[model samples]
Each structure stands twice: as structure tokens, then as C-alpha cells.
Target: MASIGPNEIFFLLQGLKWTVALTLIGFIGGGVFGLLVALARTADHKLARRITAGYIAVFQGTPLLMQLFVVYYGVALIGLDIDAWLAVAIAFTLHASAFLGEIWRGGIQAVPKGQTEAAKALGLHYPSIMKDVILPQAFKIALPATIGFLVQLIKGTSLAAIVGFVELSRAGQIVSNQTFRPLTVFALVGLIYFLICWPLSLWGARQEARLQTASR
Candidate 1:
């Protein structure tokens, strides 16, 4: 068996770029789509609300691994020839959107009902009301949860390996197989993940504290 060496470590570190890329794609796509979902959930129309709720249910209820499988293989079965990276990106985006939508929905609802009423009393349109008043407050409430979800999303990218994306976890698996050092390889993988996630968790906590203090 080959020994784990500098080259092996560098190879694994290279996977970090894909991990970071996937996280960015997931968060950016999910955040935009999720904002729409949150708005629909909060809309006056019952049909819109129900549709967004169902979307959230299906994505959030299922395992992300299954979602990735469906996106990767199911698309291939349809003859689209989607890239594995694209497939992983799409699946993670949908997965992250559902959870984010729910998080932001709660944040929207948590805003004082009177604020909405007051906006309407000022004869503001729905968009204006939301844009100028409700969403700002909701964003503050949502920031911590959004950050938390993003951190989880980053960790969850490890699941992309299941669909053949050789990210950090997959790199570890490969290194372990070659070096016959499963424990050491995976411990290093865990440490890398910790290094990425710990700072985000701390930032989220600090933001949450600041929001609470501002609220009070």
C-alpha cells in the first residue's frame, strides 16, 4: 500500500475547491429560489401558499442522497446527459431552497402583524409593503437561521460523492483505499470539514446575539 504523503494531502486539498464551489452554487441558487418560495408561502392567495408548501414538503421530506440519485440517474435516463457536478448542484440547490424557504417563512411570520397592517394602512402595495417594511425585519430574524442552514449545506455537500463527485469526502475515501489508512484519512477529512464549518457557526451565533440585542 502507498503511504499518505504530501502529494496525497495536496490532492485532497484540491477537492476543497469543488466543495466550496458546490456550496456557493447551492447557497446562491437556493437563496434566490427560496426567497420566492417564502414570498409565495406568505402570499394572500391560498393556491400559491399551497403550492409552495407542497414544494417544500417534497424536497424537505426526502433524503438528499435520494434527491441526488434522482437528479443524476433520472436525468440520464431521460437522455439529457447532465454532468455530475451539475446534477449535484441542482439537487443541493433544491434541497437547500426548501429548508431556507421554511426558515424565512417563519422569519416573515415572526414580524409583527401590525407592521403589515400599518403598511396597508399607508396604502402601500404588496410588493412595497414587503420590500420596505416586512422583509427588512424578516431578514434580520432570518440571518442566523440562514447562516446555520448554509453551514449545514456546506457539510451536506459530502453527499455529492455518492453521485460520483470526488469532493473532500470522496478524496478521503480514495486516499484511504490507496494508503490502507481509513482511520487517518477520514480523521483528516473530518478535521477539514471542521475547519470550514466552525467559523461559520461562530459567526451565526454572534449574529444571532446581535439581532437579539437589537430587538430588545
Candidate 2:
């Protein structure tokens, strides 16, 4: 068995970089689409609500690994050559969108009905009410849940390895194979993941606590 060295460590760090990149891509892309989904879910029209609800259900109901497989391989069957990076990005974005949309929808609903009524009473249009009044409060309410989801998204990036994406988990696998050190390699991998996620989890908890205190 080969000894673990700086080279293995560096390679793992490289994988960590891609993992962070994928997480960011997923979170940012998801956040944009998710906001729209949240709005649609809470819309006045039944059609819009139904459509977005269906969108959320399909994504949330399915496994993310399946989603990645469909995006990575399904496109190839149709003669579209997609890169693993792009495919994983798309899958994660869609996955994150469904989850974050639901989180934000709850936030939007949590705002007092009086707030929307007051805005409407002031001759505000739907867009104006949401943009100026409802969204700000909803954003604050959703921040903790959003961060918690972000931690999940970070760990979920490991699934990209299934699609041949070279991420942190994949890197650990490669190193473990080369060095014949599965335990050491995976221990480091777990440590890195913990380092990345634990703080966010703590922060989310703290925010939740603060929100509760504020509400009380």
C-alpha cells in the first residue's frame, strides 16, 4: 500500500474546489428559479399555482441521482452532447429549485395576511405588494431554512461523482484506490465535508433561534 502524501491531499483539495463550484452553481441558479417558483406557488391564479406545484412535486419526488442520470445520459440519446459539469449543474439547479421554492413558499405564507391586505388597501398592485412589502419580510423568515438547505446542497454535490464528475467524494475514491487506504481517504473526505457544512449548520440554527426570539 502506498502512503498518503501531499500529492493526494492536493488532489483532494482540487476536488473540493469543484465541489464548492457545483454547490454555488446549484444554489445560485436554484435561488433565481426558486424565487419564481415561490411566487407562482403563492400566485392568485390557480393555473400558475398548479403548474409550479407540479414542477416542485416532480423534482422533489424523484431522486437527485436519477435526475443527474437523466440530464447526463438522456440528452445523449437525443444526440445532444452535454458535458458532465453542465449536466450536473442543471440537475442540481433543478433539484435545489424545487426544495428552495417550497421553503420560500412557506416563508411567503408565514407573513401576516394583514400585511398583504394593508398593501392592497394602499392601492398597491400585486407586483408592488410583493416587491415592496411581502418579499422583504419573507426573505428574513426564510433565511435560516435557506441556509440549512444550502448545507444539504453542499453534501448533495457528492452525487455528481455518479455522473463521472470529479468532485470531492470522487477524489477521495480515486486516492483511496491508488493508496489502498479507504479509511484514511474517506476520513479526510468526511472531515472536509464536515468542516464545510458544520459552520453553516450552526449558523442556520443560530438564525432560527434568533427568529424565534424575535417572534416571541
Candidate 3:
């Protein structure tokens, strides 16, 4: 068996860049769409709430890998010339948006009912209430959960490999096949993922603590 060498390490590092890029793309796209979903879920209109709830249920109830597969192939079947990277980015954005929407919806609901009442008393309409009074507090409540989900999103990018994206996990598989050292290659992969995720976890924890302290 060949030993894991600098070349193998370098290839994995290259894959890491794609993984990070996918994560950022998914998170930014998802966050924007999720905010809209959250607002729809929290709206007074029953039709909007029902539609958003169904969307969330479909995404959250399914596996992300299957979502990627469907998106990759379905687009092709429909005559779109999308690549694996684009498919993965699209699938991950939808998945992240669902979970993030639910998290933010919870945060929005967690705000005191009286706050909404007071905003209404001041003649603030739905948009004004949400923008000026509700969203600010809900954002603080959502920050920890948002960051926590972000770390999960990073790890989830590994699923992109199944759709032929060749991200970090896929890179480990490639190096392992070449070097015939699956254990060493995967251990390094795990370490790299840990290195990426641990700080986000810690930051989420720190934010949670700070928010709690401020609330108290």
C-alpha cells in the first residue's frame, strides 16, 4: 500500500475550498429565502401560513441526499443544463431555508404577545411591526440557532459528493483509493471537518450565553 503523501494532502485541501464555497453559497441563499418563509409562516393570512408550512414540511421531512439527487437529475430531465455544483447549491439552499425558517418562526413566536399588541396600538401595520419591533428581538433569539444550523449546513455539504461535486468527503475517498490508506485519509478528513465546525459551535454557545446574560 502506498503512504499518504503531500500530494494527497494537497488535493484534499483543494477540495476544502469548494466545500467552503458551497457552504457560503448555500447559507447566504438559504438565509434570504428563509427570512421570507419565516415571514409567510408568521403572517396573518391563513393561505400564506399554510403554503409556507407545507413547503417546510416537505423539505424537513425528506433526506437532503435525495433532494440533491432529484434536483440534479430532474433539471436534466426537464432540459436544463445545470451542473452538479449548481444542483447541490440549489438543493442545500432549499433544505437550509426550511430548517432556518422554522427556527426563525419559533423565535418570532417566542416574542411576547403584548409586544405585538403594543406595536398595533401605536398604529404600526404588519410590515412596520415586524421591521421596527419584532424582527430585532427575534433576530437576537434566532442568532444562536442560526449559527448552530450553519455548522450543520457545512457538514451537510459533504452530501454534495453523492451528486458528483467532489467536496471534502469525496476528496478523502479519492485520496484513500489512491494511497490505499482509508483510515489515515478519513481521519484527516474528520479532523478537517472538526476544525471547521468546532469554532462555529463554540461561537453559537458563546452567543447563547451572552444573549441569556443580557436577557437576565
What candidate 2 gets wrong by more than 4 Å, as runs, is none
161-192: candidate 2 lDDT, tens digit per residue: 99899999999999999999999999999999
Task: Give RMSD (Å) of candidate 2 vs. truth.
Answer: 0.9
RMSD of each: 1.4, 0.9, 1.4
Model 3, position 1, has a per-residue lDDT of: 96
Tens digit of per-residue lDDT, candidate 1, span 103-180: 999999999999999999999999999899999999899999999999999899999999899999989998999899
TM-score of each: 0.94, 0.98, 0.94
lDDT, residue 12, model 1:
94
Q: How does candidate 1 score on lDDT?
A: 0.93
Q: Give me the runs in candidate 3 sitting further than 4 Å from their true place.
A: none
- Residue-level lDDT for 98 in candidate 1: 94
Where in model 1 is the C-alpha error above 4 Å?
A: none
Clash count list over all predictions: 0, 0, 0
Steric clash count of candidate 3: 0
Q: How accurate locally is residue 109 in candidate 1, as Cα lDDT from 0 to 100?
A: 99
Candidate 2 structure lDDT: 0.96
